[model samples]
Target: MTIQSSYPYYLANRAVDANRDLEVIDKHTGEVATRVALADDAVVDRAIAAAVEATPAMARLPAHRRRDVLNGCADRFVERFDELAEILLVEGGKVIKDARGEVQRLIDTFRIAAEEATRIGGEVLPMDIAERSEGVLGFWKRVPIGPVSFITPFNFPYNLVAHKIAPAIAAGCPFILKPAEKTPIGALVLGEILAEFDLPEGAFSILPVPREDAARFTEDERLKLMSFTGSDKVGWMLKGKAGKKPVVMELGGNAACLVDADADLDDAVERLVFGGFYQAGQSCISVQRVLVHDAIYDALTERLVEQVGALRGGDPRDPETFVGPLISEDDAKRVVQWIEEAEAAGARRLVGGERDGAVVRPALLDRVPDDCKLFSEEVFGPAMILERFDDFDAALDRINRSRYGLQAGLFIRDIGKIRRAWDRLEVGGVIINDVPSFRVDHMPYGGVKDSGLGREGIKFAIEDMTEIRLLAIREA
Candidate 1:
């Protein structure tokens, strides 16, 4: 399950043994795990040119062939499941169990894309609505939008990369992907699998380039669309530089979960614990705020503290470990400082704020100030804030106070309250009786406001990667 000493970058479906200047660290041990070749500006320009050149071949690729390519990728991923999970655990710092789950999601995403490849259908349009349109027939179908560019983050590397690559393959769009520098192994391995297929030359390239050199990915006029998943600051900056091409972004969020008086306390406690701390709470939709009704606030807080304290933190390779290290020591230090700042500002630290190197124990705080970073910004670590709410409407309003509107969760027995939250919540999706971290591979997933633009499920991404054209006929 160990990775090779060095891996090469892929350009135009061929492996280029360029100099391995970029070193990838094993997050758990803080040791250099492997090195990957880095793509420079010249290489990037060549990749974009290749993608532009291969645009027609990819567009003319039959639907059945596209489905076969995706299906083959799924099969290969299943065959090498353990290897992929191990890479995720070492390079991405995910616990072994969560790493395996992400691998399964990667497979599911490709399978879903395979199914959707053949389903990219067109519709007949009746164009005789007016007298001028008499004897006119029309139809419309989606076509590949040509070369696209993708920039993915380190968290959930496999599945997030799948969300971009799988749909591009399904919609017959050639693309270039620049994976996060912290974690490029998973995407490079995927390039190996993709090269096995007889895809059109220059159909895809997996590059691990420095952030400074990746500006071309956003500014290149040949690239038809740009897809980015990372911090809101960087996503918006790239959008401004993306020129005339369309941009799809899945930026981070500080999601909230509300617990009503009548909700199941046991179920709420269990889900909240997992939602707030899973994978060190690095996900964009990880539950960062828990709004509990006053009647059950004390009880839920007690139970949650016990569970959060009991979570194991150590080597991610251990099967018993639940809490793992953050991506780096600096990130762990940042989380610790934020917690200390909140405590100094009159917030109460309930449990688990200890830190050792990159591993920060899961933390829970009460009465966190609205202006504190922990409460207002995307923590992107294993920390959550607890708040008490008496009125349901006030609680909903509190959740809306933040600039982020990704997703929110509600645990309630009353159907009326569920409907109210559904209507009142400003997020993109509301989960009833569950945590906001819940997501299926096929579900349309994205956020509003500062959380970024556009949906990212396979079908939704396909729509973004393709353009519709109308075929019309007029009878003389």
Candidate 2:
């Protein structure tokens, strides 16, 4: 069955105007499968207006009722998991298995957010008085930051959008979600499913606005918070222009996978292949650097070469296809350019340096010079760069050299080495046994340095989305 929809962008309680048709390209075949509506300034205004109007109802809903509504949305989402997966596969270039995985992650996030809503609590405090008596009483509670703007990126469209929308719903905040233009259908479809429930009209609006106009909306003082998941460059731009509003950005990361001397080579190869090439390596937390302890460096490289060679790039709908086309031909071209630049600067491309249209075969590079572009930057493609270090301290130093501090993984059994790396890695989270991509829904997931500010987990985001208010009373 072909999933067809007319409205491209939904705003403020209605699917207003279908002015522009956003051509959605099937990443696998480079064919246009469907068109989504892109919103204009007028449409954006309507969304903003609706969010403003819905704030009162959002604030008025009791905590328990809000939890019920969020849970209902999650239930509705799980019921249509297959449909959601199909939409994601066609529109976002995610492999069928990964599309299903994203759906499951979204479900987990929603459930976690629902649980968080019920646990939103306040604390009672005792006050010491100098003016009169010691009978003064006080307590503190969290209040929702009204009119939150959620700007989600293209990678993992379904789950990332859910990460933003679910928490906003749980917090009882009116949300204006601006999903990435290239992959808007998945978000719009989810919006339709959400609209089916008795959500107070205008409580949530999904806008597919152009990237240029996105900055304009952030300038609006009516927006209390801006949550973004995208590039580090744009994340900083948001912080600058967000005015007085609070911003929570999940920015870029050149995630590292470290294999110490005591590590298992076979297991490291398995994890690296999955983490480096999944979703075409477009993930913010994708492992971009592979640091080996020089002892098993050559052996690990050979195994990685064998594994990355077998990765299949083709139709995303095919369950057997391990790799799929990138979001666009242009993005693929850019990846190609970056690899070529690295090679020109004296880096040796070991395997998989081919690109056809939007698909690039997974590539591995070694002998990366200090001046090579790939050594210091994120390729954000199915490419991995190898760096060998003899001393443990040197590997830790090299891993922390980059400006991005998102996530890092180390495969080792030495307690002292693990503890030292944990202290020296300078990232948001350190995984001792798993890949950097292993993220649970409730754990605080974020970065440090230029990677991003603030953390994103169900409960953590809720705390960031709200402000504390203390109530005090004394004998009048």
Candidate 3:
């Protein structure tokens, strides 16, 4: 299950041992775990050109063939489940349990894509609605959107990459992917799996390169669409440069979870603890804010703090570890600084604000000012802020005040309030009786506003990766 000391990047479905210039660090130990081939601007250009050349062949690929390819990948992922989870732990600093969960998600995403591949159908239109089209028949079907590009982030590297790659394959769109440099092994390993398939020569390329050198991934006119998953800042910047191409962004969010007076305190506390600190809170939709009703705020906070404080923090290799390291020391320092700033600004740290290297103990705080970065911005770390709300509508309004509107969670016993939250909340989705962090692989998952654009489930992503072509027939 150990990773290779060096791995090659894929260029046009071929392994290229160009250079092991990029050293991927084991996030838990802060040591170099593996080195991966890095693609330069020329390699990127070549990959794009290859994708452009292979577009026609990819589009001509049969749906059955595409399904087979995806199903094959899913089966392979199952065989190497432990290996993939191990890589996630070493490269991404994800806890063993979370790593395995992501691996399972990876399998599920590809399987979903397999099911959708053959079902990419269109509907027949009734052209007889108009008198002029009385004898005419019309229909439209979706086709691949030509060459596409992807840039995935470090968090959830495997499944997020699966989100893009699986759909593109199912849609028969040739694509080029730039996985996060810090955790490229997972993507590179996926590239290895994909190379075994009989896809078009240049249908896909996985390049592990520096962000600066990846300008072509966004700027190149050859790519018909760009799908990016990362910080909002970088996602938007890439969109501006993407020129004329469609862009699908899954940027991070400072998601909020509301606990109502009638909610089950025990259930809410357990889910909230998992939502706020799972994978060290590196997920985009990780619960960053908890708004509890005044009636039970004190009780919920007590239970939440106790659970968060008890979470085990250590090497991700240990099955007992719940909270692992951040991506890097700098990231850990950044989270610590934000926590300190909030504490200095009158926020009370309930428990867990210590750091050792890249690992920061999960922290819980309350009475945080609305203006503090810890409260206002996306804290992609193991820290969450607790606040009291006296009114349900006021709590809904408070969640809407943020620029990000990815997803919100509500723990309520009343159906009316749940429906009201669904109707009133500006977020893309509202999780009833569950944390916002809950996401199934097939559900429409994306955000609004600063949280970014478009959705990323298999069918939704397939929609973005395709275009509609109309067919009209007239009987004489």
Candidate 4:
């Protein structure tokens, strides 16, 4: 059954239904699956004001209650897991298998946030240095950073939204969420589930607005911080406009995977197939680049081409579909143009570069020059580039040529080699014997340089949402 309905945005605890509705289209069919409330400038301001008004209440709420609220939301999410997955399929055009996994991630994140709520603590300080300071008693505790604003992207809407909302709830901070207008149903339904919990009034809001119309979200002083997950250009612009308020961004990346000659070829091939093309390659940390040793380059490239070719790219509603259409036809066109440009720049197509509507068949290119956009910029589409390297130092250096340093994959059994990569790679996280796209949701996930600004694991985000308050008492 096709899931179709109208969803409302939250202005604090009050459900706001606007007359102007944004149509949520199915990327594959280009059909309207549902509609969501579109927030005008006035509504966006009200949401921010509501968040500011609720900050004190969130601070005063008991830790236990906060834990319960998060747990309740997780429980509700688990109960409606399939429903949410269906929405993700229609709204984000995610393949069903990936959608299911995203749904489970949502549940895991909320549950993790629930556990983190009880762990919010501060360390005791002992002051006994000098005679004058010997009697001073000093300590610090974590306090909520008031209201937070999150602007999430179209990819992985459920889990990314959870990354922001769960931490705010865990840290007892009021939040305003601005989900991608094209894929807002997952977040809107999440708001509905959160509404079932015993949360304070004016604690949260989920507004869907045009990208050009969301400047207030960044410029408003009422919001203490803005957590953005999207393209590099947009995210940096948001940071520029978000003056005074702290801003955390999870921007774009051409995350790469390296295969050493001593590595397991079969294992590398399997992981690369999934990592390089999952979700149509729209992830910030997707395996966009594969750097293989010269000795095993031919063998690994042959296997990868065969494996990637075997993938079925079709309707996301089908459970067997491994790849689906992009977010829109324009995105698919953009990807095709990039691939063509790379080819003209001397890159050779190894397998799959066909396009049909919004579906660009999984593209694998070889000999892609470092100057090509496919190699230097974030593809954020279904395309993978393979290059061979002789020296380990040169290969690693090439990885750093791009501005992005989000994550990298290294396939090696040598402990020394692994340690070298951990020390040398400029990325935030490195996966050994696997792919760069591998993430467990609990690990510190962010990038260096242009990749992102801060960490985003459950506990880490909770720390970002709260600030330390020091209390010093001197002997009378």
Considering TM-score, which of the candidate structures 2 and 4 is the better prediction for this target?
4
Candidate 1, residues 1-476: lDDT per residue as tens digits? 57999999999999998988999999999999999999999999999999999999999999999999999999999999999999999899999999999999999999999999999999999999999998999999999999999999999789999999999999999999999999999999999999999999999999999988999999999999999999999999999999999999999899999999999999999999999999998999999999999999999999999999999998999999998999999999999999999999999999998999899999999999999999999999999999999999999999999999999999998988889898989988999999999999999999999999999999999999999999999997
* lDDT of each residue in 1-476, candidate 4, tens digit only: 54657888888876777754698888888988778888878888888888888888899999899999999998898888888888888888999999999999999999999999999999778878777788899899999999999999899989999999999999999988899988898888888888888788889988898767788889998889999999888888889889999889899799989999999899999999999889999999889999999999999999998999999998998878999999999999999999999999899998898899999899999999888899899999999999888898787888877799999999988898888888899999989999999899788999999998999999999989999999889989
TM-score computed on alpha carbons, candidate 2: 0.96
Candidate number that wins on lDDT, 2 or 3: 3
Task: Please name the candidate that would achieve the greatest lDDT relative to the true structure.
Answer: 1
Q: What C-alpha lDDT, on a 0 to 100 scale, does residue 174 get in candidate 2?
A: 89
Q: Lowest summed-lDDT stretch of 10 residues in model 4?
A: 12-21
CA lDDT of each prediction against the hidden true structure = 0.95, 0.84, 0.94, 0.90
Q: For candidate 1, give the lDDT.
A: 0.95
Q: Scored by Cα lDDT, where does model 4 land?
A: 0.90
Off by over 4 Å in 2: 129-133
**TM-score of each prediction:** 0.99, 0.96, 0.99, 0.98
Alpha carbon lDDT at 341, candidate 1: 99
The per-prediction CA RMSD against the true structure, in angstroms, equals: 0.7, 1.7, 0.8, 1.1
Q: Model 4, residue 110: displacement in angstroms?
A: 0.2
lDDT by residue for model 3 (1-476), tens: 48898999999999999998999999988888988999999999999999999999999999999999999999999999999999999999998999999999999999999999999999998898879889998999999999999999999889999999999999999999999989999999999999999998999999998877999999999999999999999889889989999999988889999999999999999999999999999999999999999999989888988898899998898889999999999999999999999999999999997999999999999999988999999999999999999988989999999999999999998998988999999888899999999999999999999999999999999999999999999998
Clashes of each: 0, 1, 0, 0
Clash pairs, candidate 1, are none
Backbone collision tally, model 1 = 0
Order the candidates by TM-score, highest first: 1, 3, 4, 2
Model 3 residue pairs with clashes: none
